[model samples]
Target: MRIYVLSRQKLLLGLLFLFTVGGILAITQFTLTTPSLVRTPGTYYMANTPEKVVALTFDDGPDPIDTPDILDILKEKEVRATFFVLGKAAQSNPDLLKRLVKEGHEIGNHGFNHDYQQRHLVKEMNQTDQAVYAATGYHTYFYRPPGGFVSKTQLETTNRNGHVVALWSVDSKDWRNPGVKQIVDNVVKNVFPGSIILMHDGGYQRSQTVKSLGPIIDALRARGYRLATLSELKTLDSETK
Candidate 1:
């Protein structure tokens, strides 16, 4: 009995030791030992400003049907946004690209082919710039990677090309087709001062985005938020700093 009691106490102590060690390792590995990644220079996730303004950015577009409807809504609301154009899409729909430029909206390079690896980021960026320039005689100064994914090479190339990397703070997730009301709520609820809203005008069937656009604008306006382009947001960011 004495031996059995000693054995049981030893087992309990052993288990306690194992649990404590495991907990320490888990915390250290995931928390203190892990480093927070530094955002590369010349890249912006969202503009920093206290003003009641936001930038609406659309990605993967120049879609013929939906892009026009989005533009029409923007025009009706007298609000401007930034369209991050895919090189292939821009090449295929130069007229839409032209319309984007002519309508006082801003354009940004979204990369060619929507390549995920972005191994040749600089080339992709230049090709996108060329496609837009060919259509509208305009040069884009902002770069947002396909799928909003960022890589060190992409950021370096954007910096090398003297363009700013624009990423979004508030994602509409309209690409998910999560219903128009859900999309609007996703954006409206997440938005902050100088927020850059991520939406879609192309890359896939974006009908839901089309429907959510006007309501998002009206809701934002009702919330006393002034919509602006990426460039305008950048200007506001500068003033606050």
Candidate 2:
């Protein structure tokens, strides 16, 4: 009977040891992968300044039709905005992508595909970064999930990669073909100093966005707001390690 009891205790102790080891491994893995918590929103920082500086960012772009028009407007205005280009679109429109680079505007990785709920965001991000790097020979440190849906892991991965996840403080919803007047009014009403305004130069039916661009720029400039890219608006200095 004593032998049996000892054997049972030994089994229980072994199980306990295994469980403890597994728990430790899990915790260690999490610690190793989890991004630093210093910046909560992970990637993009909304400018906290009271200065009349706003970022104008376009997503899912370099579309053949709308992008060129938008670029023309930007050039005419002599203002720059961040373009978050999808890998597939960038693959299809290499010249547009190059044009964006030549125009002194900043480019951000919008993923290989526009997957807002991409389960493999980190994996896709690595691939996307590589693809963009290969194409432009320019390394980008900015990312935005499709539709702006991001998980904690996605945020952590981006932050670890020294990339900022750009989010919009104001959306014109030109994607929905909102009236030009409405798009204009929306910006006039919603934009504030340090606002990251969202518009799109790609995706479906962006003609409305193209149409709205001129007036939006005119109105904003008239109001004395300087529209700049995400990089220009948000000052990201190199961390002294």
Provide TM-scores for the models. Answer: 0.82, 0.78
Error of 2 at 146 (Å): 0.8
Q: Which residue runs does candidate 1 get wrong by more than 4 Å?
A: 1-42, 239-241
lDDT of candidates 1 onward, in order: 0.86, 0.79
Q: After superposition, how far is residue 196 of candidate 2 from its true place, in Å?
A: 0.5
Clashing pairs in 2: 43-165
